[model samples]
Target chain A: MKSVMIVGVGGQGTLLASRVLGRVMLDAGYDVKVSEVHGMSQRGGSVVTYVRWGDKVESPVINEGEADVLLAFEQLEAARFLPYLKKDGVVVTNTQQIDPMPVITGAAVYPEKLIEKLEEKGVRLTALDALSLAKEAGSQKAVNVVLIGAMASSLDIPEALWIEAIEKTVPPKFLEMNKRAFELGFHA
Target chain B: MKELLQGNEAVARGLYEAGVTVVSSYPGTPSTEITEAAAMYDEIYCEWAPNEKVAAEVAAGAAIGGARSFCGMKHVGLNVAADPVFTMSYIGVNGGMVIGVADDPGMHSSQNEQDSRNYAIAAKLLMLEPSDSAECRDMTKLAFELSEQFDTPVMLRLSTRIAHSRSIVDTVDRVDVPLRPYVKNAAKNVMLPAFARPKHEMVEARTVKEREWAEICALNFVEDNGSATGVIVAGSVYKYAKEALGDTVNYLKLGVVNPLPVEKIRNFANGLDKVYVIEELDDILETHCRKIGVEVIGKDLFPRCGEFSQKLIAEKMGVARDESVSIEESIPVRPPVMCCGCPHRGLFYALKREGVYVSGDIGCYTLGASAPLGAMDACICMGASISALHGYNKARGAEAEKKAVAVIGDSTFMHSGVTSLIDIAYNRSNSTVIILDNSITGMTGHQQNPTTGLTIKGDPTSAVDLEALCRAIGIQDVQVVDPYDLKATRAALKAALTAECPSVIISRRPCALLKTVKHKPALTVDTDKCIGCKACMGIGCPAISMKDGKAVIDATQCVGCGVCTDLCPKKAIG
Candidate 1:
């Protein structure tokens, strides 16, 4: 069984990334279950989704320290959900930062040196500026696809299957840009 | 073919495949998508009823008219529809009726964590709880059949985890079942004192027979895996236990949670060395086990609040896993906030500045109670704003009328606020009401309401006029103001509050998140004239922040609502 945790601010396309991953796992004949946060939590709040796939899956949530991969779309969110990762878990994180309400209102300061902090915890970390890479692919909204591609590099699934899943999941109007974004992150 | 489906989506598919003809529902989290998805099927007629009570009655009326019908609502919504739900159990159904009530156990988006199983028992209704999307689909179809066979309304209880989670489900072809013929029988349908007395006895008799049938039903079965310890679970908790214990323990999973299979539970417990009951929120199953002379371990080892995870179950059962790591540094909280250009922001900001005691209602506007805004003083439920405001003024007399107002959204005013407005007019109170007209239901992901001039499928419809409705309800003083224009809003609020009779101020603006709305240019801060007074931060707009001791607006996040610009004392914002 494999478990992946996607963490990001609300409206950052994290849920779409999980949906695409779910489709890829289902196409491979694996039993997949995806759990998401909805309602008030989607209003510029921290959103986390759990995707599990295996021969037969039961629970839709991942236990603490049980995630095989952690895909984060923001720097603070990546550090916030670090406890969900296993000791040897692979981390594919975007270096983009979106300040929380407290930090924005001057109640608190945004944490600094997040990558260095995670590296000190002895986990396998791969951090990149996915926002810039997505822009290079012709749309900044394709950052989720970029991170998904980076996460795909650590898995045994073929790049073609990921691309096929992306094609089926995204709208056709922006398909080419997302495809380029995925490839750029895959080779990052 | 198999497809990934949310639990709510599967329930709609089940309703479609069961040949249901009519469906009605009011939007609420975890339950809204069921009706939205049902509307996609051309075979069924679906609608967004004003409130849960009306939705339930509409489905019941359709059932009485010889159509298989269903209605969906969240846990609190059931409370609003309980009057119909409780009586419908005695009246029974003519065709078939299924009520989908999704419970929020962890209170994720709800005001309270309630167990809907108690409602089923109180109403003496049969209830089915599904753990996954597949069961959600299969059990919904079965619920309709059971409703017809037993001559009763059935309840399908769903929790947050089960309702929102997605899992693979195999699609099934629709079965066109002919509608049962409707016959007028006052003795069964009417609830007058003499007629209802006999029907109550009949309901009790049916419960006894249903319990007997539950004992042998295939839905309640045992799985023996050679382990002595046994766990009896139901709904989403069953999935959590299965993941934690695997096949090492004997299990009796119950799909029919209400009118529980007492005999089956006893037989299963007799074969195992130890019996344990696993459930979330409340100890409904544990209480039943004790009443039936069965010993069980529950509640004492498990929590009775919030949700249950696989790890928690494993730890309680003494299963070992690798020790979990923890982060040493504390992280800032990221609570949900209003959108960047939310329509309610300006009205709330004005209300706070006026120092008026505001009574709030449900919607995205309820965020007015959060820090920075802090305008709303009381929020009981839907439509309580108007009614509560009336009572507040009557108690405090003329002084309260000068500083009190009820703030509600357009959709919510259409829901139950109109009735309360009538109460204020008839009883003679000097209460002022502010209707924040955001043009759509801002909460529950912007579903269409009566005031939106569109149906669930987005076809044009007759929109309810707020001014005409207020006049019709006996409120002569009615005014509409653009909430974006703070000056007009302040003037309208002042005139309405000081008025002698009941008055309503409709603060009109479209939700900024709607795709059709165009935004003005993002505002820029002139640092040369900045005073760093932090007045602009009081609105709690996520787009504006204090950076380097000066107000700084993120151009990318701002939608140019410009409400914050009015707060700057030095005119430093443009």
Candidate 2:
């Protein structure tokens, strides 16, 4: 069985990214279960989704230290959910910063040197500026697709399957841009 | 075809396949998507009623008219509809009636962590709890059959985990069951003393027959692994137990949680040396087993609150995993907040400045109780704010009326708030009420309400006028102000507090996140004129932050609501 944890702020298309992954896994004949956050928690709050796929999956949630891959949409969120990663797990993170409410309200400061701090934890990291890549591809919202592209390398699934899933999951109007974004992150 | 579906979506599909002709529901977390998904089917007539009670009544009326009908609500929403739910059990249904109530055991987005199973038992209703998305579909289809067979309303209980989680569900074709012809039978339908007494006896007799059916029902079965230790579980917890214990332990998984199969449970327990009941929240099964003189382990080892995970079950059962690690550093909490351009932000900010003790209601405005804005004093449930403020002022007399106000949302006012407003006027209480009219239901993903002039499928309809409604309800003072206009909102609030009669101030604005609402260009902070006063920060807008002792607005995050500009004493924010 393999477990992937997707972590990001609410309304960041993290759920869409997980949905695309779930479709790819399901199409590949794996039993997939995806658990997501909904309602109030989706209002600019920390959102975490658990996607597990295998011959037969049972629990919908991934426990601490059980995730094979951690897909982070933001730098701070990457560090926040680092504990869920297995010792030898791969981290596919986007180097983007969205300050928490406390930081915005001046009650707390945004953490510094997040990547260095995560490196000290000993997990293999593939960090990139997915926002820039997505912008170059024509839309900033495609950052999730870009991160999904980076995450595709960590799994045994083929790049073509990921692209096919992306095409099916995203709307046709922005299909070309998202495809460009995914390819850029795949080779970044 | 097989598709990945959330439990709610599967239930909706099940309703569609069951040939349900009528469906009604109120928007609530974990259960909202059922009706939303049902609205997609052209064959079914789906609508969002004003409140859960109305939803239940609509479905009940439809069933009485010879149509297979369904209604859904969250845990607390069931409470609002409980009056009819309890009596509907005795009256029964002419056509199949299925009620979907999703319980939040963890209180994830609810005010309380309530067990909906207690309602099933108290009302003497038949209840089925599905473990996953597949069961959510199959059991829903089965629930309708059971409802028609027993002539009772079937409760399909769902929890947060089961409702939101996604799994593969095999597709099924629609089965067109002919609706039973409606006949006016006073002995069964009417609840007068003479008729209700006999109906109550019939309900009890039905329970006995249902218990017998449950003992041999296909929904309740044993998986004999020939293990000495056995675990009896239901709902989503069964999946966790199977994942944790694997095939090492025998299992008795129950799909029909209420009127629990007593004989089946005893037979399964007798076959094992030891038995355990695994359930989330209150241990209804454990209590039932003990009453039947069967020894079982439950609740004593497991927690009575919050949802359970596979790891928790494994640890409690002393089962070891392949890998387990603990981290020392505690992660900082990321609490949900109002959106960047939220209309409620400015209203709460103005209320705080006015020094009014706000009694809030459910919806996005409940975030007003959070820090920085800290305007709301209490929030109990849907539409409780108006009644709570009325009683609060009645206790403290006229002095308290100046300090207290009730804050409710547009959808909520239509739900149950209108009655409370009438109560205030009839009782002659000098309480002030602020209706945060955000154009649509802000929470639960912007579903259309009566005030929005749109139906479940976005068809234009008659919009409820808030000012006219309040005036018609004997409220002499009815005023409207834009929440974005901070000065006007504050002035209206202050005037309403001192008004001799009950008054309602409508703080009207469209939700910032609404697709139909257009946002202005993002605001910019002038660094040259900026002095670090931290006044704009008090509004708690996520887009506004302080950088190098001066306020800075993130253009990417800001929607240019410009409510923050009113708070800046220096006028640095534009």
Candidate 3:
């Protein structure tokens, strides 16, 4: 893939997703570069991570309209980052909407027609309620892994590599439940 | 593989893997982890110095001794280290010296948004901006190489974005770089007037050589496009610019931001009619280009303050704002405060009540300056509290001095407050110094300090004794008081303030959030005994709320610290 975009709010696993993508790509013998948001966004704001992989990565940043895939942890953030994807690019998104500060404070409205907008724009969109799936898998925190699993299943990357990345990335305690959530998300 | 790590943790890992040998720094946001991480490696010698300038000087000394050294600080801390940074540029270095400056662009955990890049330009040092965690690692390793190669210390700039953001970093086995043997050369090492005058001339020639050398540096690469609108940007801004312009604009992505490669930059600007420089902070890049007789547009469209996003760049670039613009509603302003059971609360509450002048220093205790607490008189920087209090006392007379105190955090006291304490003792001034010993560097996310016996990885280490240090500093009287014990705290403050000689009062308490610190069972108010004197309200605990014209305690929120129990005039809360 030329580029991948991970979208979520602060405290979500967007950073993890970008790292996993970077590692898997690096292991596959592709040069990879990634960028992310830090600082105040860690307090709960929109976060977007960029991962670009190919031969000859120079600047470690992806240009606009160049992302081959947009992996979104939240639906609205997915639509928000839709333009980053190439024309008719694929998007794997969790059907969850995290109310940003503005939405929580009533200054803005959370768009209800996120998937519809992406689909109408000729983008291939797959939406899943990863939070519910994670809850069903016995941990709400596995939502990130579930989203990663969904991306891994649909994006044609090896599922084993993604799982290995998850195992390496997460702490030892919650590995089993996270793996289960990933399996459920992959098949869904 | 992908890892779940805090931004500070990643920076530590980066420094460790970079083969850094000597690390000295004062703790500040977004930048504290680098030194903490350096401490983890057995091969690296790391310590928290008293202040930023001292930290920088220590690192500079180590570099001259032919060892790879580093100093990390937040932006404001850079202001303290600015003296060494500017002078070291002229003196140069024997080994690579990297200064890690993490800037809080939007004032996240900082008092101001001072761009550290301005420091790089003013000091004539090379600056490198890493966009993310992986680069935070890569640029750091590369910074040492560039610093040694150019014989100048390099500044590694991290914004709140890269410093606090986590991402997967490719790990490598540690390569232990032995400290090169030092050769005594007083004229080269020392900056006496005669030796320094010659070095000043060398700096100008060195800049020219660096400019030429930057032309071939691997970090600055050009992305060729058939288009004429080429954009040049460094650091995080490159991410947004690439998102907004894409192939429509050719790019000159400069990883090494300072000592602008005149030849390389001119080559890129040779054909483009409308070239724009995209950067987050001050337009140092644009100013350099303008001086070289190149017309560039930068700060004119983008902002000089705050961070930039794709949408922000798109709107500035005159593109339609994307659907992401309306993601969520604006959040209410919920400014950060001392935690629910914080021991510092009672002390600040007493300070507010007594209306005493307080010259504050850095630490979680600085939250005393926040509204509803309103206790701190001034917070200049680390180690400034005691000295500022001394000056304030000299100006205000004995009565004001008797009521005033210098409030500093425990880790901050260990960092730089000791010297000022010695200064007061030596000068025979009657100044009260309150060390708010919270047992951790609470402001930088509760990292361990010299006073705490724990390392960054939570390993047990030797803790420093504050009372013993005070006694060793030549103070005849040293008293330790539990901050939770308000009556004792007030008495200690009064005694320390009124003492005929310099006195140290250490208000010791562990942070409420430490795992070992257990809160009392939440308190419940007996409404029958409530008199609504509002004394309980004075503590400013969110757990204490008003109900039915009387003070009520939300048992769920209260930690049962009974801070409010003492505040209730009717003794209604149990």
Work out the TM-score per prediction.
Answer: 0.98, 0.98, 0.77
Model 1 pairs whose backbones collide: none
List ranges where model 3 is wrong by over 4 Å. Answer: A1-188, B1-18, B40-43, B175-178, B323-331, B453-464, B471-477, B497-501, B525-535, B546-558, B570-572
User: How far is B73's C-alpha from truth in model 3 (Å)?
Assistant: 2.1
> B270, model 1: CA deviation in Å?
0.6
What is candidate 1's lDDT per residue for A1-188, written digit by digit as tens?
A: 99999999887889999998998999889999999888888888899999999999999998788899999999898888888988789888998877888887767788888888888888899999998899899988798999998888888898889999999999899999999999999988
DockQ of all predictions against the true structure, Cα-based: 0.70, 0.64, 0.11
True contacts kept of 2: 0.60
Per-residue error (Å), model 3, residue B155: 2.0
Q: Is the docking of candidate 1 incorrect, acceptable, medium or high quality?
A: medium
Q: Model 1: residues >4 Å from true position, as ranges?
A: none
lDDT, model 2? 0.91
Question: Which regions of candidate 2 deviate over 4 angstroms?
Answer: B322-330
Q: Candidate 3: deviation at residue B535, Å?
A: 4.1
Writing each residue's lDDT as its tens digit, candidate 3 over A36-123 gives: 6544344344677777776644334444566778898877777777667777678999987654433322335666677776677777
lDDT of 1 by residue, B267-356 (tens): 889968899999998899999999999999999999999999899999999999765555677788877788888878889888998999
Show pairs that collide, candidate 2.
none
